[model samples]
Target: MREKLLGLVALDRLPHACVLESGTAEERMALAKDLAKALVCKSGVDRPCNTCDACRKADSGNHPDILYVGPENGRKTISVETVRNMRDNAYVLPNEADRKVYIIDPADTMQDYAQNALLKILEEPPTYATFLLLCTTKASLLPTVLSRTAVYSLSPVVGADQSDGQLEEAKGLAAELAKALASGSETSLLAATSAFEKKYELLPLVLEQLGLILRDALVAGSGGEQMISGAGKSAGSLSARYSNAQLLTMVEAVEDITTALALHANKNLTLSRLVSRLAAGM
Candidate 1:
């Protein structure tokens, strides 16, 4: 994920707005700061070249063009007024560098009104401005907010020792399901999904892992090299087998089932619906 992100920076292809998610607070903040530094760095392509004045200023948190916005006055939530203020500041020309970077930490804490305020600017950000929204989960933000920005997960795939038996089993099931989806065989897909028929307890983990696989597929299909899901071979096959649109549909289907299961919906019925959705996507 780091390589892919830096590659985008080097290629000057990073999106104007992005959501960086799924890591510890410190990890996410560090990454956001590094990316901000890179954006404002004077070195072309080789950004954040530590020796540059911009990089030095960024490292010291003294860069005028790199701003950090979050809850103020010990408040737990960011208010709409605060977001509007940031939006207004975003329109101003950069003070030092060619670009302005705003790192919005704890973006998940923003209420609906605050997010809508942010969304207004996100919809039409200044050409010189870039916004990085940091959160533990992208689901905490509104769908409209998600649609307007690129999303990247900072969570590394769990290692074998870090995973319990159930998680390991879920990973296997997820890999099988990914391959099944790529195969476009309803029987194969059903067989892969059958593992979750009565195992309500493992359904969430399985769906989560499966979602990661789909994320990998999207990255792979877009010509990205790194696979954060650790299912590189399956992701490759999926990328080769499906178009971006189909993969997005599959992703939404997984998300819907995961959300339903979270709300204490009937596991069997949700699982059935998930299978139908996947098959339809194919």
Candidate 2:
């Protein structure tokens, strides 16, 4: 992915509005930072050369040409005012770098009006401006907003040291868990549940995977891209077996169970009840 993106940089063919989606927020931000470095790097060869002053400043988070925009203090969504500000700033010339990069992490959280404000600029961006929007899912944004951008879907990574087999195994487990719940197969669900389900420290991660499965199912049913890793087959199956409402109910059950887990509720009971609710929904 880096090679392709950097190749675009080398060819001077970077898109004005690019949307990259990933299953995890951390990966999106990390990739956004790397892309920002490439946009601002001054090296004639191996763009985004980490040793260059531009790359060093980008690493240090003080690059003048790069901007980070997201939710304001205590806010859930990116405000329209923020989008408006970006619209005005995008027209200005870069401070020093050849291109000015705006990085918006978790772009799925942008409010409707905020997205509208951005759509205008995206349609007619300045030659020196580049916008990188990192999101977990593209379904949340308007079709008009997505039409003007180049979209990229990133695969999930558990850890640097984790092998590909282990990562695929984890995604397969999550897919099976979601498929069983949607199919109302209690036996399948029981077999898929791991002992880690009972560990409070691991509950959040477990629930997040389940939630992603259901959300991806909905996205698949609607002909949108899925954000969950290695769950494409399961998502296809669930989308065929369930309606939008059913998928939403399953997602809500998983979310509720997650909230219960976060509140320090009994894991055994909560997990059991969550399964029951999911089966009933199915």
Candidate 3:
């Protein structure tokens, strides 16, 4: 996650608009916030220091220069009116900072007309303005808008299973699941889960791999294991501090992060905290 944060900050340095796509809601939201902080930050570092006034304001959700829009009320889609508000508000110069940052969270939820309206601004955004569109999939965005923005696809962490011959299916499924989970729409998750269930006949083995991932996480948690050897380990002393149930619960949390990662959920808070929890248990 630190690696991702650094890379994103570097990308922010470039004078270009970005459409950050994540697999889970948590990951997407986290990425969006990170980008916003980077944009408005006064630290002038690769990543937002999270200590400066600009970073604090952004983190506190009151940065005058930063505008966040998302699904309003019961409506799943961001209204045309909201986009208009963005269009109108964007013209105003920054109040507190050099750059005005507009973050459209779950940008994919914008209705077609709203997206079309937003397209004009991205087509020729004013100077001193930065736009960050957060989405789970680039396909949901208008091509016109997409063409004008730099798209960075944040993929799930995929690797071999803990034991056995290579599970090619798991790897492929992991990629697909990552994309679906990152997608901001709930409908996408339901559809993807269903599709994954239908296409992959190796549920038990996949579950086993998940179990292995948990074990590695546990071993890694206690610092009992020197290093993870790709999928399987040779032989090592087992960390007996945690019970089977606790280990299982930890795995469940990891799976939650997995889902969150897919949905573009908050990455720094979720991923970093997850690691922290594992280390704590150790």
Every model's TM-score: 0.59, 0.55, 0.53
- Across residues 90-199, which tens digit of lDDT does each residue of candidate 3 receive? 88999988788888888989989999998878877878788888888999998888879877667633443532243666544433333332333445434544543354
Per residue, candidate 2 scores C-alpha lDDT tens digits across 1-282 of: 444455456435568888988657887788789889988998764567789999999999999999998988889889899889988988889998989999986688898989999988998889889999988888888999998998776764455556455545555566668767756677777666654564445555556566666666666776655233356677778888989788777766776786687678877897787767777667
For model 3, the superposed segments whose C-alpha errors exceed 4 Å read 1-12, 156-282
Give each model's whole-structure lDDT.
0.84, 0.75, 0.61
> Candidate 1: deviation at residue 250, Å?
0.9
Query: For this target, which candidate reaches the highest TM-score against the unseen true structure?
Result: 1
| Per-residue lDDT of candidate 1, residues 161-261 (tens digit) | 75577778888888999989989999999998888766667877888787777777777787766455778888888889999789878877887897788
Superposition error at 216 for model 1 (Å):
2.2
Q: Which residue runs does candidate 2 get wrong by more than 4 Å?
A: 156-282
Candidate 2 vs 3: which has more TM-score: 2
Q: What is the overall TM-score of model 3 with all chains considered together?
A: 0.53
Assess candidate 2 and give its lDDT: 0.75
Q: Residue 92 error for model 2, in Å?
A: 1.5
